[model samples]
Each structure stands twice: as C-alpha cells, then as structure tokens.
Target: MSRYREFKMPDVGEGLTEAEILKWYVQPGDTVTDGQVVCEVETAKAAVELPIPYDGVVHELRFEEGTTVDVGTSIITVDVAPGSEPEEPAAPVAAAAPVDAPAEEKKPEGRQPVLVGYGVAESSTKRRPRKGTSVPEQPQAAPAGTYSAPPTAAAVQGELNGHAGTVTLDRPLAKPPVRKLAKDLGVDLTTVTPTGPDGIITREDVHAAVAPAPAAVLPEPAAEAPAPVAAGERETRIPVKGVRKAIAAAMVGSAFTAPHVTEFITLDVTRTMKLVEELKADKELAGLRVNPLLLVAKALLVAIKRNPEVNAAWDEANQEIVLKHYVNLGIAAATPRGLIVPNIKDAHDKTLPELAAALGELVSTAREGRTTPAAMQGGTVTITNVGVFGVDTGTPILNPGESAILAVGAIKLQPWVHKGKVKPRQVTTLALSFDHRLVDGELGSKVLADVAAILENPKRLITWA
Candidate 1:
C-alpha cells in the first residue's frame, strides 16, 4: 500500500497570510526527490520557490495556478511508495469538495509534512472555515462520466436571487484574480452568471459583463459615412498584490507613522561625473557597474559615518532611539513589476569596488524579479535615484522602520559660476527626507551637506573617510 503525504503552503514572507501559486514545475505521477523545487509562489514581498522536503511521486495538485492560497493550507500531495501499482485517478467531481474540509479529515493518520524555513506548526494541518459558512458535508463522487461539477457561488446565489424567498448572505465565490478583474471592469460578479467548473466566476465572465450590446438594426448609410472608430479600453486595473501590495502597505505605514522632514540642495558634480568615467576605464573595476549612483552611495555611507546620529531608528514600543552600527543600504530600483528597494548588507563596510559589484548584482537581481525578502529587510537608510527617470528631484518617503531616504535628481549640464567665471557644470539636486522624531534638522543637514560635498569634490570620499 502507498502512503500519501500532503505539502502545505508555508509562510515564505515575514507573517504573510497568503501567496499566489505562480507556477507548478511538477504534476501528478511525476517523480520528485528530497529538496526538489516543486512550484513557485509569489508573496507580498517576493517570488519564492517551494521545495518538497522528501522524495515521492506527485499525487495531486490541491489548487489551480493563479489561486491565492492561505498560508498553512495543503497545496500538493505526494505518494511516498511510488513502486506500488498506480491507483485509479480520483474523479475531478470529487475534487470539487468545498476546500474548507477539516484538516484532520484530509490528512492520513500521523503523517506530518515539513517545509524549509517554516517548520510545522501544530495548526498547520488544520483548515479554517471559509468566510460565511460552517463545515459542509462531503459530496459523494458521481459514477464515471455521469456527474457535473457543483454550481459556482454565483449560480447558487443567482437562483436564490430569482426564486428563493430567503436572502443568502454568503459573499460570491471567485478567485482573487477573477475578483480583481470584476472590480476593474466595474461589474458586479453576483449579477453575472458563471460558466466555470464549480460555478466560479472567471476572467472571461467579467469581460463579457463589461462588453456593451450591439444595436438590433442599423440605419441606411449616407454617402460620406465616417470610418468606424476602433474601440480602446478606457482603463487598466492592476491587482494590488504581491510585491506591489507589500510596497503599498509599507509606504503608507511609513508615511503616516513617521513625521517626515525633507531638505533639498543643488550642487555641482563635475568631479563625480569625471570619476565615473575614470572608474569605468580602471581594469580593477572592469565589468562592474560604474556610475554616479556608486559615488553617491559611497558618499552617503561616509556621511552616515560622520553623522552617526542620523543613522538611527525610533523605537516606538520602548520610546527609545536605537542607533545602528552597521548599514544595510537600500537602493531603490524600478522593475517591470514595480519599484523594489533591494539593499546591500553591511554596505558601510564595503570598499568602492565591492560596493559597485553589490550594486550591479542588486540591479540585475531586482530586474529579474528574483530579489529575496531577506535582501529587502533590515535597511538603515535608502537611496532613490529619480535621476534615471530624467526628473530633477522630489521628496521621497522613508522606508518603514528606517530613519532616512535620499533622492538623487538628474545630473544635467547647467551654467554656473566656477573659477570666478560662469561655465556649464554638472548640476543635480538632492532631497533628503528623514523621520523628524529621530533625525533633527542639524543632524539631517550635516548628513546631506557631507554627501553634497563629496559629490562636488570626489576626492572628499578618500579624505573624509
């Protein structure tokens, strides 16, 4: 006899409640080994791959791809004894049982599944009741090819709406992506009939609801009939989930919780720009990212060293100021998904060449959307290079729990007084925003001034350090 093991969704991010199944690498009957990655999931922080801890044959996928599964729910099942004769496939109709079946009922006696990083919690095997319903009775599997899937929540509710005398309070049943599409299309899913298995509303249903009906008949065309205009979609709605959702929540918390104070300064960076060119030519720094941001980041590190007080965070629970001896410097990079700030750990201790290498790796990783949550956490300060977007500058919000964020504007050639004469100089604006409660005006000013001085004269990096 073959024993089956269930693999539950683990909490990949810090206290995240749920994650969307992005893709599955293995399927039913596929042989898997210990520590083999079975699927990839996207949490609010980043995309992560889940590895099966022990070897077995994949038995079943509990949920479809793009389904947002709550943490701790079983996602896949594996049969440990693969050499045994393959059992008959379970009927798809039976698989339609309300996913809220009791955890004890689903698991075989005394079998525990463990995931990496997230150890098994006692409640890990239990399934919480779905919103607005008690535990439902298990439906019997229909004879082969004789039964249809259960009605979707929408269809059941629709029948209630049309014929039932009593009102149903249960919310409509749809996947997160389907709900987002319904929201984007300004359609009430409850009013639309469902055609999907299990009566679930799908993306096509939402789009169908949005489409306008055509005229029954057309009038005779005139000699000069205007060309039919191409219909364009009025708006695009992106679901606020995954990394984008995390960024939204963190930014809102930082903005409202912290008393932000912003300071701005314009300075000449002719020397810094020239140093970028020099570094590019240096064989030691070959194949490394050599840019003005490199010098700016180095300058910021030096400033933090000089004005250490500006590098501290406000501890709300204890009402104390916690000063950091190490800096996890966050570099804000705009990716295809959204803006992600992945940082270099202990950046204050890295040399210029090391910093360049870290920055290059960070950019490449973030661009590929492979940045891990560990790379994004524990930052002391952040740098947002709005300069890449060709904008002069704007005040940037502080990353939550951090004291300060520095914004670097576009470095443009502007006429300035140099050597007692007017000349075109490499000019840029710097905006520094800090948690006012933690960083006072004098401390913030000194840090910004130090960074500006280094950029204005690149040699200050060596002397100041």
Candidate 2:
C-alpha cells in the first residue's frame, strides 16, 4: 500500500503569495527526508532554500526549475511508503505521455516543472540543450560540502562525478552563456581548466583563458572564419521565467499602483561629513565603513520624530490611512542578482554607532541575497542613495507597503553662497516622494523640509525640534 502526499510550497514570508523555483536539489524518484533541502526559491528580496516537509520518496516533480508558482502550490509529490519508487526514470528521458496533467499544465521546453507566478497562465517556451545531449560522465555533482567547481573542463568533470546521478561526460559543464562564449572564441571547453569551487567552470576563468590565445598564436589568415563571424554569429535569447520574471512583475506592480511625488533639496553637509571623518579615525569604529549615508539616515530619523506621517502608509482596502509610529527604515541596494530593499527593524531606537553598524550589516546581507524574510518585512519608510553611483539626484519610487521614499544624491564639491561669499562646499541633493492620497502638500513639504534642514545644519540633530 502506498500513502502519497503532495509537498506544497509554503508561504516563506508573511503573506507571501508566490515564489519562483531557481533550481532543484532532488529529482523525482529520489529518497528524501522530512527536512532535507529540496529546492531553491526566489522571493521578493532573496533566494531561499526550501526544506521538504515530509519524509518520503520523490514520487513526481510537479514543477520545473525556473518556473514561478503561487504560494501553497504543490511543487513535488512524495510517497510515504518505504518501498515507494520515485515517479519514473531519473535520466533526462524523452517527453512522456500526458498523465492526467492539469488543464493549465504546460510543457514549455518539454520540461516537467511548473512555472510559479500570478497571471502567467502559459508555460514558458522550451530550452534547447547545448551542443551535447549526453550528460557529463559521472553526472552527480561535486560531493556534498565540496566547493563549487573551478572554471575549467577537468574541474567540471570532477564536479559531475560528485553529482547524485551519472553524467555522460561528453558535454561541457558551463552554462548556456558560457558555452556561447566558448564557441565564439573557438576554445574547446574540454581543454580549458576550471577555477570555480568544487571544480565548476566560471565565466572569469573562461575569459582569462581566452585572452592569452591570440597572443599565444599568430592570427589566422583572412580566408579563415573572420574574428567577427568566429564570435557567435547568432544571438542567444534566454527566456525570462523565474527570478527575472518575478522581479518584472513586482517592479510593474510597485511602479503603476502607487501615485508618486518627488521633492529635492541641496545641503552643504559639511558638519555631518566631518563627523564621519572623525568616526573613521576612532579606534572602535575601525574596520567598519563610514559613509555620508549614515548621517543622512540619522537626519531622516530625526526628522521623522518631528513628522511621523512621512513614515506612514495608506490602506485602501478599508478606506483608511494607517500611521505607523515605529520606523522600519528600508535601504535600497543594487546587487548582482537584482535591486532589493531590506530594512533595519526599529531603526529609530538604535544609537548613532549602532545605526552605522546596522546599515553596514543590512547592505552586506541584502547584496549577498542572504537577508531572511523576517528582516525584510515591516518597513514604514525607505532611502535610496543614487549618489553612490556618482549622480546628483533623482526621484525614487516608493516601496510597495510604505508611503514615502527619499533619494540621496552624490555629495560632491559645489560652489555655494554662504553667509556672504561663494565658496566651494560639499553639497548633495535629497529627493523625497510620498503617497499623494495619504500625504497632502503641507505634510509632504514639511517632512521634506525638515530632513533638508537637518542636513543643512547638522547641529539641529543634536536637539529635538
């Protein structure tokens, strides 16, 4: 007798509606424990590894890697019976006959996993296998706990041996983009050495191996494939189905749903900058970064004390505007994965040094995409420093739940009229945008003006206004 249970993707975050599958750890037919990591999922802020909720054999994979699925959707099915076999052949087999598949069950790329998301009714298009259809010999990836592969062919082979399954070994281990790069350079990946952890091949390794080639060998005659043609003559198009797709949807939702207004103010920022320099010279703050944004954040916090409405939000469902006294200050950061806004909890209560440390930790975690769901939620206000990119200032979109966002422009040398003479001073711009429905012109201007005042005169932050 076989007892079967479906493992639905749980809401990893508060009120999370859905998640996109990034990759799978186990295939259908594999035995899995109740708490073993089964797959990686990307939410609004970070990529999280999901643990299987039941101890069982993977009877069937309900969704494919790189698909977006709604929360509470079954991602994998398992059989509790001891002797249960995983659904079918584990190898990449030919497309199977439909077995009571869902009406919306699509076979994009002829893959079995379901794409997770809202309003995306159709499956994504199919993904073509690279030049070799055969799995790398000793398919199981590097042993558990081993570093990922180095960027090279031999390293890739080593990683394949560690995989759970057998690899055909004839194919290259690099991703589609890397493969294209190799083909364009006429560099056979099998001959290149991998430098990635656990013997995996990395893009940098490929690029490094490529540059020395031309210098090492004389250029081929004009009759040979021109360098232009040698570089992949055709373009590769990757389907936007997983994290990217989810990001697109979220950006759109945040962009159009909220009506936004922006206000900018320029400040000398001399005293605050001086404070940061002094802090950098202190022994206690050594090894920690000191930036102008810390002062700007402190200024914003002080201003929030004078004007609480700036940190509030509007709740349209109940026809009410809710005001949050506590501040969950979100810092918008750009990472390799994408732009993520993770906030510091109750930032208003932390001391100046503590706030600096918190900001440092928050940015580092968000950039690595390791910020937990708990740390990312419950935000009341946000700040984005476009100044770091060396820009003066620009309007910033409000984070979905919060009512206002402040953009800090670059602090640079600018001539300004002070007391009586024009002199070179460190100046920057601050742009504030708020929810017009909840914040009227008066409140919005007052809040923005207050923040600007604190920056213009850092001493104002010394006392309550």
Candidate 3:
C-alpha cells in the first residue's frame, strides 16, 4: 500500500543476465521524470544507460558503483507520491482456522509469491513457533510431540479474513524467482535452512546449499607472525567479469573448437594509399572519416563478393554450414572495457561512402563505449586492424559464429620491387585466418588473393563492383 515503486534492471541486450553499474546520475531525494536517464551500466558487450519509466523522487540506490546486479532485480526505489503519508500493508497472521468450521471452506486461492515469507502449502498450514516462550510443563499427551504449540497456532485461515497471510513450517517458504533458482541449481528447498525475516528461505540460502560444506578442525595454536605487507604491494587480483569475462570464454571456446588455417600475404598498397588521399579531397565524402581501414573494409567486401563462399559459418550442432549472401561486416575495436566487434548490418548492400560512414560511426561508438549488443552480433566476417597498434600482422583467431577474420598490419614505407625496379613503396602484410571446416586452403587463398589484388591496383574497386 506504500507509494514506493521499484525499478528493476532490465535485460538490455540479447539474454544478457547481468550488468555492472558504472555510474549513477541521480542521488536520493532527487526528482526524476519519466524516461529520464538514471544510471549507466556495462554488460558483456557494451555500456548502456538506463532510464526510469515513471516520475518519482529517488528514495534509495540499491547498489553502489562497480556492483554487478542480475537482470530483473530491483536496483532503485522511488516514492511516487512523496508528500503523502505512506500506507503500510495489512500484517499477516500465522494461525490455524477454527476447528468447528470445515477446513475445505478455508482454502485460499494460491498465487506465485514474490516475497520470501510464504510457504508451498496445501491443505493444512503449520506455522513455526516463535522462540523464548513455552506453553507448559504439565502432564500432556506425548508432551505435544517435542514442544508445546503457541496460543496463536489456533488462529483463523487466510480466507477467514481477506487481508491476512498465513505461514507454515511444514513447507519451504520462497518467492517464485527464488524457487526457480533453487530448481535450476538442483537444491531441495526443504533441506535449506531459512535465514529470511520470519523464518523464510532466501535466494542466498538456496545458493549456499549447493556450496561444499566446510570441514571442521580444532582451533590452531598461536604461531609466529609473518612480516606485515602494504596493501596492493604484493599483488592485486581483479575479478574477471563483464566484457573481459565474455571475451575470455569466447576466445577459449573458438580457439579450441575451430580448426584454423591462416594464409599470409604481403602486398604493395601504394596505389590504395594514394586513393585514400584522393578520397580525403573529394567533395562528395565531406566530413567523413577517410582512412586505410575504410578502404580495407571496402576491399574485403569486394573480395567477399568475388568469393562469396568464404563468408560462411560452421554449424557443428546441425552438422551443416551456413552461407551468408549478405555480409554483417565486423570491425574488431579495442576499448577500455575490452575488445568488441560491432558489425555493420548488411555491409554488402552499402555503397562505398555509406560503408565508410558506417565504419567511422562504428569505430567512434566503440571508442566511446556506447555500442549495443545487437551491433556486436550476427557478423559473417571480421577485420581486425592490428595495424593501429603498430604491429606488422597477427594470426588472428576467428570470432565465434563467424568462419573467417582478416588481420591488417601496419603499412610502412618499405623498399620493394615495383615495375621491376627497387623503389620505396607503401607496403603492408595481410593475414586471412579462416575455419578449415568451412573454408579449405584453396577458398581461403582466393579470398586473400582478391583482397591483395584490389589493394595493389585500386582500380579493381570499380571494376570488381
């Protein structure tokens, strides 16, 4: 009956279970309007801001910064009607129904509980007796089966009054979500001891049930003290979580699961470099980012068009390979959180300038940590410009769900044979790594060769298109 409304953390992207709170824009007692941005959170792929759905005065911030909260859990509480006095809900009575009246008439309609104070009760309800009070030491039948019952045990049923709730010791008390958690974890609720208010089992209690019980031992005797060390001087442990954790798991899975075959090609990109300079001066591409990466991405797209078989995915579970006609070109970007690949949707359909603009926006969004999870999914192929890090080239690992990835090395002015004469030319190495299951050596070689050819002659971009 209170005016307090709680806002839960939502699943921002594709079945993401949790997110770490990065920053809060509002404090307690601050007024917020509907759709007002309240807090920023970082999930496995990117950082996102959450907005409040209704107007209210912030009453509480449930978690601090850097705390990872599960989706659907309340993270904030607000008072909608702040000036009005809060109304307390009717208190529950844990007592039995009248023995004279038939218990069948006292049955209450069952509803999934959201709080931890209700039990999985059926016909007869049994409430746990409160501590410190005993009934009697008088002569009775079997001492009332271990202990005397409370006087309140003979109270009315839930149906007796429309407002009162009943609790029983015969069954486990848990909310629907906690019950699901218990079921998912394979923990029997009845065996778990309740630590919640009024002797109800909580989510923590259910999780603790699955943990290995600590071994017991006698207390150790006093021992010599070791040298005192300053905090963080020896070592600091950073918990693997968020994007970094997802990256680790995905990389490990892809590395072990895929049979990778890498093909390296050192190319002369002097013409491509010149073309990039020309594009910078073009009026049609005004205010757009024009760089070698833009050209490389375009060249890769053109190469995919030439050899569409390389844009594929190996479906191990179905024992099939998926050939994608449209390319969601993934650009591997490095950010403070971790490396994320936010791909352009339908990159094969975009024009040269459109592709360049998309590439520019993708890079900027990734650097600002504002990319969405959807942008990071459904990629047919990827390009990792390790060149930006000044590395010549790397044998890049294939992204999960994608069959191939291309690594672009730094373009340096090198002495090379051009027109059969030794001359200083802009040169770079390109490495194409693909899954052997989907792309064989011949197909992989063709894709790499096409990219090299397009870069070497810059005119091929038009002829190939």
Candidate 3 clashing pairs, residues 3+ apart or interchain? 96-155, 126-168, 126-169
**lDDT tens per residue, model 2, 285-365:** 777757888888988898888988777777779878888989989998776555667788899998877888999998876
Candidates ranked by lDDT: 3, 1, 2
Ranked by TM-score from best down, the candidates are 1, 3, 2
Each model's C-alpha lDDT?
0.74, 0.65, 0.75
**Clash total of candidate 3:** 3
- Compare candidates 1 and 2 on lDDT and give the better one: 1
Q: What is the lDDT of residue 374 in candidate 2?
A: 55
Model 3 C-alpha lDDT per residue in residues 182-233, reported as the tens digit of each score: 6557788899988875345776898789963211111211232555668879
Off by over 4 Å in 3: 1-3, 28-33, 55-57, 81-234
lDDT of 1 by residue, 1-465 (tens): 124667778776757899989889998999988557788788877776677755678889999988999987889888765666544432222112344446543432222223222222211012245567665443333222121233334433433443323323233445533443455457887898877754456667777888732111111112234455568856555567766788899899999999999999999999999989999999999999999999999999999999998889999999999999999999998765578787899999999999999999989777766676667878889999999999999989999989999999999999999999999999999999999998989999999999999999989888989
Number of backbone collisions per candidate, in order? 1, 51, 3
lDDT of 3 at 457: 94
Q: Evaluated with lDDT, which candidate comes out highest?
A: 3
Off by over 4 Å in 1: 29-31, 81-232
**Each candidate: RMSD:** 18.9, 19.4, 15.2
lDDT-best of 2 and 3: 3
